[model samples]
Target chain A: MAKKTPLDPAAAFRVPSGLAELSAIDPAGTPIGPQDKESGAAALADLGPDLAALQEKLYAGATGGSEHRSVLLVLQGMDTSGKDGVVDKVLGLVNPAGLRLASFKKPTPEELAHDFLWRIEKQVPAAGLIGVFNRSQYEDVLVVRVHDLVPPAVWEPRYAAINDFEQRLTDSGVTVVKCFLHISKEVQKERLLARLDDPTKFWKYNPGDVDERGYWDDYQAAYLDALNRCSTDAAPWHVIPSDRKWYRNWAIGALLHQKLTELDPQYPPAEFDVEVEKGRVAAS
Target chain B: MAKKTPLDPAAAFRVPSGLAELSAIDPAGTPIGPQDKESGAAALADLGPDLAALQEKLYAGATGGSEHRSVLLVLQGMDTSGKDGVVDKVLGLVNPAGLRLASFKKPTPEELAHDFLWRIEKQVPAAGLIGVFNRSQYEDVLVVRVHDLVPPAVWEPRYAAINDFEQRLTDSGVTVVKCFLHISKEVQKERLLARLDDPTKFWKYNPGDVDERGYWDDYQAAYLDALNRCSTDAAPWHVIPSDRKWYRNWAIGALLHQKLTELDPQYPPAEFDVEVEKGRVAAS
Candidate 1:
């Protein structure tokens, strides 16, 4: 028996080789829109055809009715790490009816009073729907660990609790793909400064973001903990490099396209005879 | 002003004339195979370019971040009457991230305990997202009224409640398009019987649907009341003669295209232009 080699963060994860057999284009390598297009709109324009075909597949998978599979795509990342952009781009390929997007922020007083996962559970998509968590349960680890918001003992158990929660979803037939958009600390500082300089974007910035930045190393350590503990075959974590928006979108789109096509739901078998239909046609 | 006619069951209200537009083809056309030369699929194949253009328009509207306009598309009809099909076809046009779909079913214990509109509020899409309601709050007027599930005094108030709901959504800049897929009783009978006779479709049929059919006249009256009371400048009803599935798909697709174009959201004033460099663009 051969021992499997551990994954190296520096190496690109091998793209599943059989993906090309599923569709005409590789979502991962495909630069949407005109090749040299610099604008988001231009890039988005390039995405239309692949997105449309993917949406058709998604809708067919959803409405075929026999399959009970659900999917939860979780995007977790630092501020301005392209989580929103990922939702904006990758979900472009899905049927909105089949998708749910939930963005989590600081817990409200009511939310804090309950178990951490309470509000998160309500947002889960029912069978045949895809739920996207812009920020998710792992915030308990990332935020609480960095800010020391909860006493260590209270927050520590949450790492295990979340793992179990996601495991349950996967066991119940949810294709859970979690991505952490990794950006350099220098990038974060630049974005925060930009937010402050622009009045129109002032609403998006906070003095608190800088405070959080002071603990960047702490958050990364916590993230490493969560990822190592929760990466199961049923729901694996893909670390998306965020220095490039195009690459991030392509990677996430490829991941989702791969998972959905694997579900392969076809129309239910027809029961009525065409000859009977011909008879009715003749009588009519 | 012209003198108003007194209400009469036989002739007081009119089905919107827009339904006739769908009949430019046929109200009772059959489905065609993908490769068939004269098939409906062949005609719809041309929608690809139209759909791609619609995607660009949708992304443009959403990014503008304007709160001045919103749009909600509501789909309602009998079992197998093509409500799901319409959603599958038309919603495929918009960017999925900018769209939301809420499917209403039997009121949960929590929902039944409140004003009928309570559960609905949480499901309303935020501004910049197109919301589609598969079945909707109109259930109080349609189902509860048809089945006498609630007393007249209880369910009757819902008509006004529903009107107020639409008024608020519109006042807040949400354009509402409600569609009822209208198929004659004989066509419905054929569909229902098809479901009963087919093993694959057995899961979709409900014994109660047969029970409900006994009250077809009552259901029609209920839909009439709901339609007349709820249709307003803010949210008008489009009745689609749905005996022809292809026409239903096309009509609903056109209506959505029209509504979103009317919404016409533009990009919000530039808030961040951090060098606006390739992927490195940030706020500062």
Candidate 2:
């Protein structure tokens, strides 16, 4: 039997440097993968070892030498868009030691008092780690705008602020991959219903989802604005059509696999002489 | 084929509350799992789904209701005993969202200025998460004692301090599982030589490992003292036979599986009226 090669989702789904139209993307579509769940899952499992080995090399590079590079994956989406699911199925493939995961909830009083970037800056992955932001600095424009939590004057400059911050991170050797998890309004309602129907998932449902759903159009407009504006050469955004859970997970896995391969982190050369170390160990 | 039945390691290897003997334990023995490497690995892989489900229930119980419980696994072993290996094979099976991992290195100036646990207290897992400490507060008694990093006056009282701190944690809803990964001195020598022999593993070799090995007897004495003094009803130590990598990983997985099953976290009941929420979601 011939070996099955998988899609390069980093290319298939990558939004060009500066533009995105969420409405044009299909929530349930498989942009470039196996057409069904089983094949998609098999392909995902195939990527695991390669992904783990690549992530470890990146980690080894930092500890043994001057490799300072890190990757930050920013997951942005409305509630119930499966940000958490993608994290489990995709990012979970690597050694957890290689991951620096931070989930941003509503701001605490201390966080609200600082510049929005302050807390985020504190959590950027250390050298050679892959950092994932569950929700991120982009919320300053999305949620803070939609809920009228802040006046337009307060939230308006955040798009420029985010771009500047990402550019600075890139300049310092951080490669940023931003993914917008796009699910349709109808799909979101079905998901909410499923959460209500299942005892296991009830904890995931928020009562406030109804209020958010009422402003669906407004949220979409806000998201489109943020998506269209904040992307750049160093920090491009990928629109992951996330209605199908398997495809979403596999796509993110493929994307990460591609980026890490491009980074091509080498195991740091031994700092100590091999023969001397061998003698020391044998003697011990 | 009849199903394979694995041993309950929580029962098999758990050091009885309040006592331990490091010298009596065999590092290469498979205390409970299949003796062969391939069979042991199969058993560990077989455990993934159940462990993932149990962990998710704990997460759900916390999110939807009043579950405040958490589990902390403390992993301590001499160099090259495979602490990192166990973490990848075991903890990496569950949802990464459910894990909070901290690796302790030599204290920084800031850490040294405070009480030994000042840095540790900051990183405990939140409600419903599983926290893994790569090396833990026990180091106050082990490494500190071996190297004479502190006067006995400073390190002597730490055994009682750790007990008091852990007792408080148990009373406040944390379940602590401590494991001392046991590997023979000969195995450590072999492993160090292997690292020296492989280019890929050179990054893991530290020249100081030889210095530490020179004090092997002192370190074992220190480890024996800590393990003996610290076992309690709420926090017992399990001495994992870690020379065989597959068995070590499987035993830890089984130990965790048993503890989580005993915890038996229930999915929280729906907070909203299921019927009303269904109506709302359907209308949305």
Indicate which candidate wins on DockQ: 2
User: Residue by residue across A1-284, what tens digits does model 2's lDDT show?
Assistant: 11224557777887655454567778888978778999989988988988899888899999887789999999998888989998899988999988999999899999999999999999999899999999999888888898899999989988899999999999999989999898999889888988888887899988898888998888888988887788677787888888888888888887877888788889999988889889888888
* Model 1 per-residue lDDT tens digits across residues B196-279: 565545445555566677777777777766776777766777666678777667656555655554455443443434344212
TM-score of 2: 0.96
Model 2 residue A210 CA deviation (Å) reads: 1.7
DockQ list for all candidates: 0.16, 0.81
lDDT by residue (tens digit), candidate 1, A1-284: 11122323212432232322211223223233223326534544445455445444444445544556777889998887888777766775555556777889889999999999999999987666778998999999889887788899988888779888988988887778888777777767676666656644554544556557767777877877777776666667766666567766765665565565556544344334534543442333
Worst 10 residues of 2 chain B by lDDT: B1-10
Q: After superposition, how far is residue A160 of candidate 2 from its true place, in Å?
A: 0.9
Candidate 1 stretches with Cα past 4 Å from truth are: A1-69, A79-81, A147-154, A171-173, A182-219, A241-250, A257-284, B1-69, B189-203, B207-211, B270-284
Q: What TM-score would each prediction reach against the true structure?
A: 0.69, 0.96
Considering chain A alone, report the TM-score of candidate 2 relative to the true chain A: 0.95
Global CA lDDT computed for model 2 = 0.87
